[model samples]
Target: MNQFESLSRRAIQAPESGIVAVVNHGRLKAGLIPLWAGEGDEKTPDFIARPAAEALLAGETFYTWQRGIPELRQALADYHGRLFGRQLPLDAFCVTGSGMQAIKIAIEAVVNPGDEVIQITPAWPNFAAALGMSGGISVAAPLDYVEGSWSLDPDRLAAAITPKTRAIFFNSPSNPTGWTATPEDLTAVLELARKHGLWIIADEIYTRFFYAGGRAPSFMDIMDEDDRIIFVNTFSKNWSMTGWRVGWIVAPPSIIQVLENSVQYQTSGVPQFMQKGALAALEYGDAYLETQITKASAARDLFCDALTGTNRVVTQKPDGAFYAFFRIDGISDTKAAAIDIVDRVGVGLAPGTAFDKGGETFFRACFLRRLDHIEDAAGRLADYISSL
Candidate 1:
């Protein structure tokens, strides 16, 4: 067999990230207002970065606790208490390298080879990609998209479960769609998991980015103590620490050790200095987070209005999250359209083809940026759509 064919089937069959492909094409272009990635255009605030740099310089660079440092975990507990109004035990938190790692760990913990995980779509592509790498299958339960709004249908989700299904990977205030689940939606999905004896991997990293006054509704608001839910979150969004690669998991205490063991085997643990920074973020970054939310709220309005003004884009201001996912009236092949838009307009956008099913005809633009930049990108994109 050839060298490529000799690799494991899982490794050989893994799909390239469609988002990254477009990014690679446009990354070098001058004056590109890139909005393809799911991050804000801010650096880690001094309050958070200074401590980590000090810690690293002061020799805090050793291997650390597999779960996390006690202070950081406790801080996570406190943060949850404030955000979710429920005080969770420190044992429930397991630190991972990033939110992506947390999802992989969750998949490894609950899914065996050939097991299926039902994910809501059009969803972030990473969960399915990670599941496939772990030898599990990803089954899609696409959301209901009507007009410019997206929502869940309980019966549709319940229909996706099968005898081999082991878990449900749910991302609210979703990456591309910006579809925030309502309390009623959360309750129905929780009830469905209760009936099916399936685990839930909740990705609520965008909860704080909600534009509707307060944070988005979460599974924590309604789950019982014994419910099988695992929360995967990151410091990337709220604190502008995407490059830090620090995230944490909140699972039942009984499974924290199991998840930590997975950590033990993969990456050992997040770097100690980084954990110190994360602690600072949980401790002193609330106001900074609020500022990011405010920026996102305004950008959401401005960008959505600009797109809708073109009358060739189908979108509304998303209920939450920092992205505006819309379909241009004449663009059918989004992957090619993304490349053309970036080349012609100098505005980088993620093609809906990167997102899973039900998203193939759309484009996603991250709007968490300076107002002027958003205005510029929006104006350029509006002109592009007008020309179309």
Candidate 2:
């Protein structure tokens, strides 16, 4: 006789976020070094914030088009063109509240009830959640964690496709895993998507965090205007604007229309001032982004070397992103291990199971904090592993 009993079965069956569960368990404890989310400790730069403030001062805070203000959309198109060296047009770009919303909107627009989406794992849980919230099924095709790094097997992914599969979900410089898909991998996947007549939902949110270069190889670099690709990115990583909640998507004109309609029902558009801030980021964020990428590259080496000192834990320096995804020998219950480490060592990390299948015995720790904090967390984690 509970009032909440009227909720639908999907609502009842949806599991809690394992990352949030661990964070909640550790929140009350004092002196905990948290590295549970895909975020850094840096503040948003003055140049980006000033524009939004100036817009407010100039009294431009009314509602705009749900699709986004035309200037921001055009700015994003031009920025991507400059970044990727491809001529992206304004018709292909749409703005949303966040990258998560972009993924959700793209999923809902492309899929119907009972449709299956082929996703590469160990994926961010939201990828599967987006599919589920749209009444679609997710088929996980895991990447091979070979010799210390994660690699994609395109044939394995192609094999996962079935008559019910409507799309393929791809994340490069993947969250938690930090695997950047090769250009060859992209070509292979594109061929499969074409063969199966499937859509491609690409999460390139970590594009600016590449370790070796200005940006990671992207599907956008090679995608044609008519290709079945929906690319999603946010201002969070490059501009450190996670709290701003501004993300953009690139899709075909037909789906762009759907995204416009979806944006109306989603959040009725992001704030006009916030869109101004995003435009500023597109204009002036390059130098700051390069600095952050250099910092992350250094931190990756420091953290990975710390874990490599002991043979008990297996780890690889990530090619991109700010995560150290590693495995502990003989431990199958990663969630339990992660919670125990939090309780004992005063360090926090996300368990492998929280991501998707093939994550057992693995965990993800972000290294985007201050160097001292990263060193302290690294020492604590290494000490815990050595003691085990």
- Tell me, by lDDT, which candidate is best: 1
Give me candidate 1's TM-score against the actual structure.
0.99
Candidate 1 lDDT tens digits, 292-377: 98999999999999999998987989988899999999888999999999999999999999999999999999999999999999
Return the lDDT, model 1, position 161: 89
**Residue pairs that clash (backbone atoms under 3 angstroms), model 1:** none
TM-score of each: 0.99, 0.97
Model 2 misplaced regions, further than 4 Å = none
Which tens-of-lDDT digit does each residue in 1-388 have in candidate 2?
5767888767776768879888988988888999888888898999999999999889988988788889998888788778888776688899999898899898988899999999989888988986887789999999998767888999899889989999999999898789998899999999899888999999988878888777889998777777899988788877889899999888887778888889889799999999999999988888888788887888888889988887777788888888999987767898898889999999988998898877766889888878888888889988898788
- For each candidate, the alpha-carbon lDDT, in order, equals 0.94, 0.87
Model 2, residue 333: C-alpha shift (Å): 1.5
Give Cα distance to truth, residue 228, candidate 2, Å. Answer: 0.6
Clash totals in order: 0, 0
